[model samples]
Target: MSHGLSIGDLAARTGLAVSAIRFYETHDIIKPVRNAGGHRRYGRSDIRRLSFVMAAQKLGFSLSEIAPHLHRLPDHKAPTKADWTRISTKFRKDIDARIDALEELRDKLDGCIGCGCLSLKSCALYNPGDMKAAEGAGPRNLTAITT
Candidate 1:
């Protein structure tokens, strides 16, 4: 007998669509084995793995960012507490950086809104003469805080 849960069973346990599970598989977030009949079979550990992925995504982590951490774990086996502790240590650093950035943005946003200069090119605040445009596209002023 194949020693694992079917894709459908994994999806039900994780509250994820089977398609989403497949998506994570593509990113190396989970690796399911194939039964003799060629059906995908997920180990019980995949439940915790997918659960961790779900929580990480909720915290704004992209799959690319998460893949490296999970890849270090043993495939088809539950991660040890030490394994999770290491990952969380890294995540905490990222979370701290994001918090600092958010605080900076909050402090700056008030000043920008209060300045009452709707014109980007003429704003004396962060981007005088739209000089931030030289930095590249996307919310240049907001994202340029650390850059």
Candidate 2:
């Protein structure tokens, strides 16, 4: 049987600030038991949950998005390898989409810089003929290249 831990023990184990752990509890990402004196009591699974939360945050997930996934993990059972794989697949797809968008923006900026066109309407890099500029769909100015 796993031993129950105090909030301070959980914080020490996870290397997270006590307040951050408390914040996660408040956000419903974790639920610790209340002791007789009302101090929070955590369990072994809290370690795994908080680890997942920190990892998700490092990958740029918002607290709201991470909360649901953390909550879905079985409380009494550790997450299966398949569960992690599934979650990673979704995160990978999101990362790929962001990379593709960034690459496209880089290419467009390169084209704009190469052509040295200053006018937004006349510049192929900015205009794209579909009137993306008129619709105000992209970067407002060519200054991005310099900065």
Candidate 3:
């Protein structure tokens, strides 16, 4: 049987600050057992949970977004392969959208950089529709560029 670990040990293992681990607990991402002295005691499975939390956060997933998936796994149990597959699919979709947007932006930048159009009115980066500037200027020449 795997014995529970102290909060300090968990922090050291995960390389996360004690407060961050506490924040995750407060968010209900990881629920550690409370000892008689009221000290938090995490189990071995917490190592995986904390790793997932850190990786998800680095990928720009909000706590609210990651909560449901993390909560699906019972305490002291690792998430199943199917659970990971589902999460991976969602993450892949998010990544694909970001990649598509970046590619479009790259194409637009390439076109604009090579065009040598310094004038904002003729610049494809600034104006894709070739919109003429109004007689009176506003605060910013806000032109919507549709990809």
Candidate 4:
């Protein structure tokens, strides 16, 4: 019999629902071993892995984006502080860029809200009707902020 936490134990410790932990496993975010009776067994390290997954999700990183970095750490082993620092650096630049974009969008929103007409020459100061419409259909200023 393997001495490890049960799935319920892991869910309790991580404050994640059992179904959510199972979902994470489906994505390869966590791997639990099966005991002799065919019950899943999880080590303490899975706690940290689940926590990292939650934090990455909170930062607006998708599961696909988070998977590669999680692959670098050994399974069933706790990651060292250095390992976390190294992996998190990749996110810092991207998160910072997103923050900057959102801030710029917020600033531009004030001017755009003043007028609903992109047809206005004055409205063209931020988004010219012909230039924006030529590219695609949507508020050009907001698209520019995101893209």
**Top-scoring candidate (TM-score):** 4
State every prediction's TM-score relative to the real structure.
0.80, 0.69, 0.71, 0.83
Report the C-alpha lDDT of model 1 over 1-147, residue by residue, as the tens digit.
Answer: 247999999999999999999999998888999988998999999999999999989988898898999999999788899999999999999888888888888876755432334464436756666555666765665676655
lDDT of residue 22 for candidate 1: 95
Report lDDT per candidate.
0.82, 0.71, 0.71, 0.81
Better of 1 and 2 by lDDT: 1
Question: Runs in model 2 with CA error above 4 Å?
Answer: 105-125, 128-131, 137-147
Overall local distance difference test of candidate 4 = 0.81
Runs in model 1 deviating more than 4 A are 113-122, 125-128, 131-141
Encode model 4's per-residue lDDT on 1-147: one tens digit a residue.
248899999999999999999999998888888888999999898898889889889888899999888888878777899988988898897788889878877877667632346655567675554455665666666675567
Prediction 3 global C-alpha lDDT: 0.71
The predictions' CA RMSDs to the true structure, in order, are: 3.5, 5.6, 5.7, 3.0
Query: Which residue pairs clash within candidate 3?
Result: none
TM-score (C-alpha, index-matched) for candidate 2: 0.69
lDDT digits (tens) for residues 32-64 of candidate 2: 777778877787877988998898788777898
